[model samples]
Structures are given as structure tokens and as C-alpha cells.
Target: MPLLVTDYSWTQTDSTVYINVPLKGAKVGKVDILSTDEYVKVHFPPYLFEAFLFEPVDDDKSTAKVGNGVVLISLPKRTNKEWDHLMISTNDKEKKKVIRQQALLKYQDKLTSESRSKAEKKHAEKKYALETMMKLEKEERDTIQKMKDTEREKTTAELAAWQLNQKQKAEVETRVKLQRQRSRQTQIKAVTEEQENQCSGEGNVCKSEANCKKKQVVLPAPRLTGNIQVTFTPRVFPTALRESRVQEEEEWLKKQAEARHAVNADTEELKDLKEEHRNPDWLKDKGDKYFATGDYLSAVNAYNLAVRLNRKIPALYSNRAACHLKLGNFHKAIEDSSQALDLLTPPVAANAAARARASVRRGSAFCQLQLYAEGLQDYHAALKIEPHNIALQADIEKIRDIIQGTTADPDTQ
Candidate 1:
């Protein structure tokens, strides 16, 4: 007879193979399955599935159960060993069937035979029982050994992970401490340079810290004209005494003007006559370009324009907050980040990343401002959104360290 073709799905465990095949509208009696130690064949009307076993199975223990719209075949392996694959191939179906039948007959005949002596039968039974008990004991020992091995592997993995975490934490703490020390040294160096610049080339050297802080032009109180004090330009003050102060004030004003001008220029460009330039996305991109180039002032300008154009956009505020953070405008950074947070609604999937970034930025600004309590709160909130962010965790630890250090410092309170 010719073999029928069928489509099926199968899965295997340690000792059993399960095959499921579609057999809609077919009765259970119509489904026939033949099993052998080395092969299995299934027949259901127009469909047939056959495969050479990857290993031997106990044919008598195999079963086929049909229900709903499917036929399920369960094959029991003769030994407790695992099969490497489901089957070797789809060949030798006829030859394997003949061999399986002969084996089945021999097994049945052995079961029914009465020619053996009573002594021999008792010995055979006892031998079978002893083998069964040894097999059970071996399986129990194997199970216990496997359980111990798994637990040991688990402990080793956990230890490795803990060691990695500890190493990373130590590195982060060292880096943060070095950064703090460097920042302090830089501040001291800047102050020394400024003092040197103020005192350089002057014939009258400041003899003490009090003199250095005192006004060089210690003029008498200005004369009042009808109860209104007259205000004169720095030029009216003594030239030798006022020159440095006047120049410093002028330079400071000029820098402020340049910064304001740059912002105004960026906003004006974003708001140009071209309609395309007014788009929020275009303005945001422009801001990003400025930020990338380290022009945070101009970036802030662009982001301001973008926010004005689309106040509802959360990203505009978040990006603006980042620029503010870079520019050391902590107050503005906090304000913009708060705006971003307000715009970012709950069920964070919609803008989780944006919300997280905004939180980190706000937290950093708070940390810079010495508001560790608030900064720690923001960091914790950000962590809820990205629990596995190593950098965020490091920041949280740094903030906690700051809090602890501040609490311990006598000067801080």
C-alpha cells in the first residue's frame, strides 16, 4: 500500500513524545497508530505520518488519544535516557513494522509460557525486582545530584553578579570623589588667578585680606543736591583708583549683552519670514544642532522658540531643560523640567524616556544647587522608569553620599 502524507506538530520530554495532528470531523476509531521500539506509523483516512525513532521505545506503553479536532500520540521511551532528536528519518516503514511485530510476539509468548520450573520462575521474579529497586535508587541519586549541581551553579552566578556590582560601585564612587576634588581645586585656582589679576602691576600692594576686599576708591559720601545724591560715571572717580573696576564692569556688561543677543538672534532666526522655520520640529532640530556644538546659549534660544511655537510638546521643555543644565542655569533647568513632567501624563509608555531624561536633568540641577533631598527624590522617580540604568543608580548613590556628607559637616548646618 502507498503511504499517505500529513502535516503534524510534535514536542518531547524526557521519556515521552507527543504528536498533535488535525483530524477534524474524524472519529476516534478511524485514527490508527502503530508503534515499535524503533519506528511509529499513523493512519487517519487520507493522512499518514511515519518516522524512524531516534532511540528505542516501549511499544506496549505507547498510546493514542483523540479529542476535539486533533489526534495526540504519546510514545514512551524504553529507557530513561533522553533522545537527541525526535526521529532519525522517514524511511524503512515496512521493514520496521515487520520487526516490531515479531518482537511483540516474542514478548507476549514469554509472558504466557508455562514450561519454566517453579524455582526458575521465582529466581526470575526476584531478579527483576532487584533490578527495578536498583534502577529506582539510581534515578533518586541522579535527581539529588542534579539538584545540588543546579544550586551550586546558581550560587556561583549570584556571587559573580554581586562581585561585579561591588566593583562597579567602587569605581563610580572613586570617579565621583575625584571629580569633586578636581572641581574644588579648579575653583581655588580660579580665585587665585582672579586675585593675582586684580593686584598685578599696581604700585600700592594690598597688605592684607581686608585691604584686598576694601574698595580701592574710598571716596567720601557723595554731596546731596536738594536731598538727592548725585551719581557720577566711573570716569569722574580718580583715574588711578577706578580704572580696573570700570573696565571689569564694562566687560561684564558686554558679556551679558552678547549672551542676550545670541539668544535673541536664534529666536529671531527660528521665527523668520519663512513659514517652515516656524515649525516646532525645525526649531527643535536647530536647538539640537546648537547643543551638539556646545553652544548651549543658542540652543536654549532655539528651544525657547520651539516651546513657544508648541507649548504642548513635552520634548521641547525636556530638551530646553538639558540646555539650561549645561549652561548652569539651575533655576531655569528646574522650571523647564517641571514643565516637561507636567506635560508627560501617566501610564508612562507614551513618553517614558522623555520623562526619565527630564527627571535626571532636574535631579542634576537640584544636586548642583545643593538641594540633595529634592534631587534624591527626582533620581528615585527616574529609577522607577528605568530600574536597570547603571548611570542613574550611580547618580543616586552620589546624591546619597552628598546628603550624608552634608549632614556630618559642621559648616553645612
Candidate 2:
């Protein structure tokens, strides 16, 4: 049997009752409290306190606070009257047992109801989040469809205009050709008539015919020929010739051209795209615009198309890696960044910035995946390219601190 708490204090007003029970250094966490209109119980391990009120009090309006080595309970009276005692003076054990069972049952039912309410609230929140995601997906689809339709309309209009212009040009050229033919025929006939009249008037048919024939057979002037200087524009990469590897650049260009031509325009996604939209450069710009606007999914879509059009472009893969990073697709980001780094070869000045960016993006993805050692290597590579970058230096220091177990929060980056 537990020790009974008897040295408790109580005070009352016309409508309220306040009870104070000393905890004897008991922790708040270890205290179990239960209350009802007719009964109250406080259980603390080896000590127990029970109160059976003399008159009914409103449990619904009651409050409890546990602090400073005490448990304080405030109970409101059901009727506007003073309670003569904190507990009822009773000797019947069966009556006390019956009240305690009833209070326990009520408490269990209240707990069940509260738990059900919390579950319903959590379920509602999940449903709302799912619905919001679906709505956003629908909106994105609608926007992409609108863009496709607009591009299709514009391409159609341009094709129609070009066809009409070509037709008009052909008509003009046909008319000019016909006029020149007619003028030449008329001139030949007039010259022939003049020659015949001259032959008849001279009464020397043979001589006149010979003269006319001689004039017609007169040799054309000898063609003037001179040396014609020919010059060819040097085919080279965008970088300065002195600083560039011509062979590698040429090979890179050849690969890019092949990649651009390799796109299967007959595919469902590409078949309906405008000619301009099929260009990797245009798609890259589109992706950049979407990224700037915080539409990472759309940006990824655009970059995907660009990569399909020309897989050799490092910037396309690098930029798409950024979109994947923002979307939290860390693995995909790492893949794209690695591909970009692979394409940014020769380690020249022209590609130094691109290589640095690819390295940093890959490092960020690796760090996000908790591959700190691999991430550190990539960060170091990027820092080498931009040694004076303070932000990059700071990031390197943070990563080092994380690796050394000196960082309080590894997830700070």
C-alpha cells in the first residue's frame, strides 16, 4: 500500500476551490493526476492522494499547475456555495471504489476522443498537401501546353509568310525572263529584215549575203583575264587562336555538330516543336529563364530538351545540374555535373570558369548527399580555379570543419 498524503492545504470561495499538495521533492514528470467532479487523485510512485469532494464541483472548469515542489489544483464549484471540507467524510469502501472506477472510465473515454481528433487533423493536413501538389502539377502542364501552342502558331505563320514570298519572287522572275526573250526575238527579226533590204537594194545578192554573213560571223572580243586574289576566313573556335588547342577544339566542334544532328526529330516530343525551339541554344536560354523565375521543374524540362538536341554542350548539363540541385535531386545533380566536367576538357582559360562551376555544383550535390570526402575534393578543385573567391574559401573551411568533427552542426551548409 502507498503512503497517503494527508498534510494538504485547501481554500475556497463561493464559486471556486483551490487545493495545494506538497510533492516532497517529487518530479513533475513522475506525477500522475486525475480529476472529476466528484473525485480527484494524485499518484506519485510510493505516495498517493485521493479526494472525494463533499459537494459536486465543475471538473470542466478546473485547472492544475505543478511547480516548485508542489501540485496546485483549482476546481470550480457547481453551485454558488462554500465547501465545508475538501473531501467527503465517508467510511464505506464500496462507495469510494465505485466513484474511482467511474472517473477512470470517463478519463479513458476523453483520452480516446482527443486521440481520434488528433489523427483526423493529421490526415486532413496530409490531404491538403497532396491536393496542393497535384494542383501545381496541373498548372505547370497547362503552362507548357500553352507555350507549345503559341510556338506552333508562330512557326505556322512564319512558314506561310515564307512560302508566299517565295511564290511572289518566282512570279517576278518568270515575267522578267519572258520579257527578255521577247525583246531578244524582236531585235533579231529587225536586224534580219534590215540585212535583207540592204541585199536587195545593192543588186549584189552574193556580196550582200557574204557581207551579212561576215557581220554575223564576226568574232567576239577576246576575254580579259587577270589574277583574282582569293581569301578564306579561318575556321577556328571562339577562343584566341594562340591560346587554343586547335585539334581538340575541332574535334569538340565535330562532336557537337554530330550530336545536334543526332536528335530524332521524329520522336513524339520533338516532332511538334518549332524549328527554333529544336535549337539547343534556344532551349538553354529557356531553361535559364525558368531557373531565374524559381520554376526548377520547368527549367529541368527545358534543359532535358536541350541535352537531347545537343549532348556535347557542357553548359547545358551544368545548368541542368543546378536545376536538379534546387529540386533536391542530389544524385541527378551529381550525374549532370560530372557529365559537364567530362565535356569541359583541356583545362584551358576559355573553359576554366565552366569547369569551376561544374566542380562546385558537383561538390554541393555530394555534400548534400553526406559524401563529405568526395565533396571536399570537388570543392578543392573549384577553389584552385578561383583561388581568390572568398565564398568558395569559406565553404572549404566549413567542409573541413565538418570533416574534422569541429562543426557543431554538420547540416549547416
Best by TM-score: 2
Q: Give the per-residue lDDT of model 1 (tens digit) for 1-413.
A: 32344567788887787778777566777565555567566655545566667877876788887789787878887777777777775467687566555544443343334334565889899999999999999997797678678778998999999999999999999999899779877876776677776676467565677755653323246567666678955543222334547776678779999999999987777665588667889989998999999999999888877776779998889998898888889999999999999999874597888889999999889888876667877888899999999999987766654443312212233
TM value for model 2: 0.47
Q: Give the per-residue Cα lDDT of candidate 1 at 312.
A: 94
The prediction achieving the highest lDDT against the true structure is 2
Q: Estimate every model's Cα lDDT from 0 to 1.
A: 0.74, 0.83
Residue-level lDDT of model 2, residues 1-413, one tens digit each, is 46789999999999999999999888898677888888888877567789988988888788899999999999999899976788889889999878876876676556556767988999999999999999999997797677678778898999999999999999999999799778877877777787777677666564644577864523247679899899967765432353346676778899988877765434766789899989999999999999999999999999998888788999999999999999999999999999999899889999999999999999999999877667877888899999999999999888755543335335633
Count clashing pairs, candidate 2. Answer: 0
Which ranges in model 2 have alpha carbons more than 4 Å from their true place? 188-413
Clashing residue pairs in all predictions, respectively, total 0, 0
TM-score of every candidate: 0.34, 0.47
Question: How does candidate 2 score on lDDT?
Answer: 0.83
